[model samples]
Target: MPRARPPLVTVADVRAALWSLVSTAAGLGVAIALVDGVHATNPWSVLLAALVVGVGDALLRAPLRRLARAGGAVGALVLGLGAQVLVVWAALTFLPGITSTSWTAVLAVLVVAGVVMACGHWVLGARDNAYVVGDLLRRARRAAGLPRAALRTAAGPDGAGDDGSGPAADERPAGVLVVMLDGVARPTLEHALQAGLAPTLDRWLGSGSHRLESWWARVPCTTPASTLGLLHGTTDAVPAFRWWSRRLGRMVVTNRPADAAAVERGASDGRGLLADGGVAVSTMFSGDAPTSLLVMSRASEGLGPGQLFVRFFASPFVLVRAVAGTVGETLKELYQGWQQVVRGVRPRVSRRGWYPVLRAVTNVLLRDLNTALVAEQLVRGAPVVCVDLVDYDEIAHHAGPLRPEALRALEGLDRVLGLWEEIARGAPRRYRVVVVSDHGQSLGDTFEQVVGRSFGDEVRRLLRERPPARDVAPRGAASRRGRSDGEAWGPANTALHALRPGRAGEGRVLVGPDRDVPPGPPAEGASATPPAAQPEVAVIGSGNLGMVWFCREPRRLGAAEVALRWPALVPGLLASPAVGLVVVHDDEGPVAHGPGGTHHLASGLVSGRDPLAGYGSRARADLVRVAGLEDAGDLVVVSAVGPLGRVHALEELVGSHGGLGGAQCEALLLYPDDLVVPDDERDDVDGTRMLVGAEAVHRRLVGWLAQLGLREGA
Candidate 1:
């Protein structure tokens, strides 16, 4: 038996396996570099990563194989891939920023690395192929799909090939600008893109640009989701509004992490983050006090970036909605303030005009974004300049989209764009500019009027259900039952219950839990239970209704259950013909259910269009189909091209985007003949359509660039 024992696997075998794995990874990486001659990492660093991967594979091969055999080969691939990625990541992690200059050098280095990796794979590793290598390349390409050239239509149909026939990509253009008009759907934007509003855009369309359709926006039409998607170039791990109220007990509009932090803090302190105490209670009625002052005064000093932003915008309307409960609180404040004034006590000046307040908020937001843009330009100095205007959106929300106010806002944004173009033109550089929108808007009524339901009624009903609810009190418990009657003592749980009978002396029977006094015998002298009280419900119209219920306390049920309420609330609202969508919220922000409720965020970008078109699609996602850069929309609601498609309309909020409607989802991409061809057919890039505008424009641009021979300086 001993003599018949087979030879044991040796270190040489393990080494071979390790080398194969290394070669496999290297090969794939090289393939990526060759195709897209842009690397955020240096060639030396990449090589170093390759070497580390080789070493790591050698060390982990036996273990990995054993684990793979035990955990399945699929598991092994996962483990191997993870390790390889880690090695590459580690190599780049400690390094500073990366820059790329020479395409030839990059392509050559990638090729060598890829070949070595392939050899290593062949020797020691698994059965990954050139196809696998290509897959990895595709992933990288998708990640970097949003390129300045692609955005500006400078890439052409085949996508900026590195050949002597074409004009040097460097000589093609300097500043490439892309502006998105959020919520302007495909059909809506297409009409305008086809119409000659901007001469540059018109040229692109006339030349036949490659066109791509059907990229989905994330839910909810929130700016964070849309902008982040645009910046990241994909829809994975989107930044959606956190719906569950963890900290404040109820969700109005808080992001996820904030909700979690609120819950945790509430648990620790035995208090809800939403607990107003004195300040929150005071500001609701008259809207005078610095509502967030109390919260900020007590918060920790070293807050994170998000917390900092929240802290900056923590007003009452910005914070919690306590209209009903705060009535008493407001009375108290007025009384106190009057006493102070009579006694010659004066507080500081107030910035409280409604219009001025709106203006101030917009101004601050504009200033912040502008500062960020300027700083980025100064630091990066990239050839492309993308500007997103929010003026149209701001005015559209406050004033109807079609109103003069909204138009004024659009004009202002145009002025800003004009100034930007002027600056670009004056500079010693050439730039190509493109503008787009996700959807268009409708005009008619307000969100409340269109939906025919009162959010106030819903709030009251919810409070009545739990009379101990802060907003409602039970019927006549105090008057019917004297303070001395302990047996009859009970809180007036709801406003309806507050009118009920209490004890022996109590006259008429009323709605409440316990009797404070004996109810008078029924009219016929028979002891009978009184009829249940019914709270009056306000009129609910044909349009939709949205309810945002904030929780009063932080609990596990608070987060999960409150968010779940959106499902129950939306169906009823959607029953109306005019009510197509409903978005509910609690402490976590917007809690939505149904196919239309929970979705990706919409873009906050503004488009360059006629005033009518620009304001209509303010908050919708901006669906961008350009390659090399991320599209600006998260959710796109496409509406019909014409007025017959009109459903629900409002004044302050007549239209919004975030759904996959005809108008909000579809958009236009106009490019120049020197840049693209507008083609309707979708091109598969890693199984996803990577369509541009049209074929003719793409061909013309490619041909023109090739004839120019700028790569060889002909």
Candidate 2:
């Protein structure tokens, strides 16, 4: 069959095309006037150059986009600039009245093109900006008596029942709005409310219409794991924020798109919490929603209605505001970091890297974008909308969880929530606001700072003290050998190795047929033989949680095997003052050991004092379940807690999660009082029961929607 010709361009298309041409011309004219030592005799010449450049760009856009997708962000940038430079050269050659022909002119054209493209993208490509413009248009239409009702009547039955009223008084709420404040633990938020840092939350807490409740997050309380579980109702195989997979022979970082997608796929049961005309914004996973924005798992897919870049750029005001805000926020973050340093803030990490930029993006750009998108969703009467704001989380990671900076972020988030609440009140459908969090953060000094050495370093020290054998080599020697063989073993790789099953405390050393043998001098009166390659060990730390793996073995090793291989390994780890608890798998089941006593996970029996005494009642069960995962490390270690309720993180984070200690496990949920919780659900330990995990939270939310008559039933 012959392919049909593309549809003829409409008047609107022509208008848009002309707008692009004019915008490009104006941008180029401005650039020419601004560039030093470059003169444009006639503005008409700049317009001619813009016409040439614009036509070229229009012709090349598809190919450029394709190249960008193929080459990634950096490669696409370079390729796009080079292509623009060529286009400018061609324009200069063909255009009349263009006197400038120097490299400086070409550079000016490049800058102009960049500015125009950036502004255009910021307005038209951004979803947040689109919503802003769309909202304004909607309001204008409403003001002119072209209300949503008229549009809905014309569109058909889908818009019929949205008259902002129901048959009965009980049937008030038409939808559910869930706001997830990432990393704001229950205790932290409560303190913020009391301290007046979170005025909106404080008001909500005092309001009789809402009820505040605290819940527990399951083990490995990271965003990916918690969000997947909450959205899809399961987080079966997710080990941690980052974990080594023997099946894949690589480390899987959940924040990465591919890894997040994999995790989403594994956890999903076809029907997600937001499957009923839901919208997910700024979340790690999409909850299988049809519409998603800034969701890591769905990032590879094309931009959805939730993306605000295009819409933002389309509105000059929003675009300029964002650009100005980004500049101001960048400086603000730098000043804040500097202030922290000068103030001698305790338990602070160096926020000198990409942190300042990331902070600005999350706090200013992302926060505003999310607020706009959520308001848009509410106005459009989305059945269920979930948005994740992570400003406090990012700030808390560098500063302490309750630090003034983090508190300020919380205050900002509370204001966004207040805006959402106000928008919901005016929305086409009544919305029951639900506020929750994925997980909480714990504040303390890091293990390396407290112990004066890294976890991997201590493991290496223990390995070096032992005699070298065919299966065991010094960690330093192994690392050097691995580097020489082109298989470099860095700290991260060493952590992965330490979590595997093999000879205990082995550093990452590659041993194969092609491995290079280091030359060495003969011992006294004996011929020298190159040292046997030691198996690599990885000692990875996520927050206070640490995993020790022996990489030489293909399968997870039992504690007995580890003990037999390296007798001093367990003792050395236990002796470390920073290590509070250690759990290792045995032939029977997992066992938890601590300075206080040992707990047998299988029977929940304690040999001496309980190892999980101060952690919580759920700690033993949570640990046992995580230890049973197939990809769990050979040995799991948790940092000790001090008398003042501080836990040491394995990573250099001041505030962290992914282990049981402090306020990390405690999370919060604030929902309207009208939402009913069934007795059966209240008793449900990990499911529809009270909030035990993200899945339970998901269930409760669905139930609330059902009660509000948003869905058919729970």
Candidate 3:
């Protein structure tokens, strides 16, 4: 398994190369004309200068990347500002026919070269994703210096299905790449394919190289819950992205390292989807993967440091382009927000402050870095690799699902798919590319906007009392972040949110509850600590889903108990036009209540108007399962879904999930067709499947892997 031959130059490659040459010359000509004492003797000397610069860049970039990674983000900043110029100056010095009298002359050349490279890459790189992917993979492979034995697995012999005695999975070297496109609804995905927003995906489907299918993202439809099931075969693993864990007596936000680690400890069994030589990238949990990068749960162990900014800014061209893009995107957001204000775009959130910068980072730098990381994983010859691309999700949170910016994020992600597709063709082992979504986003006005108060405020209003409650942060987290944790991830959500006036509900803390009570009892999900002071109830919202739990009770308070404790609360919410349905776990079972009637989940007993109506046929069943969870809220409140398919999000997000309604439950999966039943043998089977829960999706994914000669254990 010697290193594979380099791909032959194609028209695209030739075009890029030609553009590079022309841009270099253009920059050099400017430098010669503008600099005080800079000259190239002949036209050939100019060509030599450009060639030498390319060689200098090639020689310096790897070390620069190393230096950037070692220096962390500060190193990347230094490299972006001056390292490319150093390479340019060094390259200029090599030409015997060229002359630079002073350091200023060299500086002028260096600056011009920097501008040229950045501009050239931006213009060309926008057209291609494979170039970046290939370069990253080559470098990762070169950096690895893997063992000779592992290198032999690159072209391992193909084997048949496991019969019984022989281990076919061990003998075979086929792999699977699962790409989770965050918050992409099936309806939106089809819209993107048809509207030419996702050209690469459209091409694949149109050419019949792939098949598209939709799956139902179940109760508490969210990335944390969905990914938990997919990776670890654990349904009901997470109650919600953010939930009240009475057992811990602290707020559990899955994205936080300690919280994620705690949840993973409870859920993973070492035989997860990634148990066998798998790699996890940019995920909440590692799924027992031997190697995990940018995974929240593994971060506690110092697995993958926050080196994305460092690695990304190491390239001066990328840094300059990204900086420009960030500014442009910031302006675009300001314009778009103003446009929305004037035009009155239905169901949009406030887009202001650091969000624009955050948006640019997620949409540009983060995406590029994540793709590079995945390419590195592929080069490492891992059996399985799963990565989450969150560009669209972040945009849609504020812009709404169908907005131009959100859709554009989808288009950029399509290029990422193309990169992975190309990588699979020459991977160390036979690989199949499959795209999935943890959940989908639902478009909506926020509950506060519709209901005239935030969910917390509403709860307080209903209680008619301001019971003292303390802010309970996670064990390792500060009670107050002030937007700076001061680590590799020191300047993330904390710093960003600190700049803006904190919103009542969400749009504030990105993790954990704003208020919580001390531990109640030692039994049944309660912490060991004794309660000092307790809030009457803890109210937390995940998108459209709102959870209310009585702080004094270790167990879920039943419907009767809820009614007894706060008689006016459920009735008052129902009378309000903003409320849709309120679900409560009864002594008998989970029951749904509406403005008109009550529907028991276990018995299908409808007393008045069926509350779950318009929510879909599966809503009752999903509720039944969610209600059974140990940390299930005492009362689950869902905001009204408007006539136009809008569910009012309990959080500040415009396009949100973690509740049933609209397209939030509908997830799209785009996978290679040949792998899932042979192309010739199967019918044109591209449609939606009723994957009732994330658990079902987990089974389906494991089955797909089994078809690829992988073990079906997970």
Candidate 4:
């Protein structure tokens, strides 16, 4: 855990002091110009008053914030705006710019200053990011946990390139920074680079300092599965993002903290990508890193909005900047969504209800926080640092992956990458930066929108059944809202969940939670789970992939038995134009049935039309791998892929992933040019050698660590 930051007047302190001085000066100037509340003896008195006000806040604000956080309904990570206002009031009362006798006039200045300053920052548009960027960079040096006295540097926020005169190097191995830009495909990144959206990376690649290679994100192409392989070097993590854990008799949605921990325990065996000495930031799994920030699996580590993260968040104008960004981003989403509807953009999902808010939080707040935490570790010379930037992935889910809003979010992620690059210049030891994506998103209309009903509803229609008592996915929107539950560990309410006075232990993953939980167990199966005690079959997943599980069966049901039971369910699903294939375990092994023919997996026999036709060359192998997992569903359904690379998502996302279709599996890896790949792990794809599967990518990453002398071997 990161220790409490010591009190010192450092770079961040100076910059914050400066920004406050300016903002407060502006506020006091407005009061002196427009009101009779403040009287200045001389011109310098306004500046003096601003500095005095900053000092007052510096002294009294924290205590008032603590009191409010402890005494009221306000969350721990709340802005403490009231406390700040109080400090401003108290400071102005004693300053030459204000009279202590006029409380009403003081109140007038407070409201006017608050509104005007907030408006000023908001209208500053993109320039407003300076607040977060400068604040984080300032805190980065101090947060690195290295000595401050000798850490003089020419490379920093205001400058670049190390001066070779700083803190003495420790006798430790060089480090690697592995960054994941979630749901960004290889092609998308190429487009971004070409469009000059990611100038730094483009320059690096052009300068021959980096090599961008295409990779594959295999079947069950979801964050949980890919994250597991990337962090733990294991492929058989949970069967899907949400799965029935037979051992634990509960539905495991890896997005949930406790469930994430369970999945990590099942996959990890002591050593992981960051196991030696590193940090994991804003990722699903910890990679066995000694320090984990915003990692779901390590919720017990208990950093959250507690003192450590709060100090970083509570820094002057950091939260205000985020709040302003959040508001602007939310409005942008609303306007964009409205424009999409008005312009009749096809294959779009509704960005209504809580989506706009979620998008703003993910893109603005989480992105900034994750960047800050990762930058801190880099400056500290950590052996391995892994971080995830979900800005693109989150927005692309609602807005189409190629839409302007989503691409704009992608551009912001690129800027963050550039910031990290800039920060890396001053590190004590040399570091190789490797950037990759967990999975890519495919765009199209949702399955429900296409068919005018959900897969669950379709299954129920075929089987003459009603909704299960407590199904994880409801009959509505296949893009179940629960996937947005990020992590319990953060600095704000959106970021941190454990803020309630007595409910700190029960972290809030709630905004619009329709968590994927299973139906009640069958009366017969001893090892089955049900949310409310009603036994029934379930059709889950809201992406391109859908899974059918029979709660009545203790073990997975075979194709022959399923045909014997609900004979119409299989044939009914196969009949839908939205469905491409129905995969089920057969007597001869797993069999895939398409509209035209059947493909037998075990012997690679095609009775007629090959079921894996347009899905891609790797579809068969990917399906074979997923179908063979221990907890795979009784039947797997994949939406049809159109010639235009369009897919019908099982859930309610305009852009989606989780099965074979389009660019969803087309991931990328941008690594340092010096890293070499062995011949055996490379597979030829379209005449270019590409790394296949998440496990293969993991091996390559491990090799890089060994090559850097951070670990024993690849």
Q: TM-score for all predictions?
A: 0.36, 0.70, 0.80, 0.84
Error of 3 at 369 (Å): 0.7
Q: Please report the candidate that would top TM-score against the real structure.
A: 4
- Over 241-347, each residue of candidate 4 has an lDDT whose tens digit, in order, gives 66664544545555555556667887888889999887888888889988777677765454333332443354444555566667778898899999999999987
> Candidate 1: global Cα-lDDT?
0.31
Tens digits of per-residue lDDT, candidate 1, 568-630, equal 334444343444433332344322223333422222222332211321332222222210011
Give the per-residue lDDT digits (tens) of candidate 3, residues 96-120.
7777777777876766555555455
Give the C-alpha miss distance for residue 244 in model 1, angstroms: 2.6
Model 2: residues >4 Å from true position, as ranges? Answer: 1-173, 305-309, 465-535, 679-690, 712-714
lDDT of 4: 0.69
Best by lDDT: 4
Least accurate stretch of 10 residues (summed lDDT) in model 4? 482-491
Evaluation by lDDT, superior candidate among 1 and 2: 2
Candidate 4 residue pairs that clash:
472-517, 478-651, 478-652, 479-652, 519-530, 520-530, 542-651, 543-650
Candidate 4 — number of clashing residue pairs? 8
For candidate 3, the per-residue lDDT at 534 reads 47
Model 2 global lDDT (CA atoms, 0 to 1): 0.64
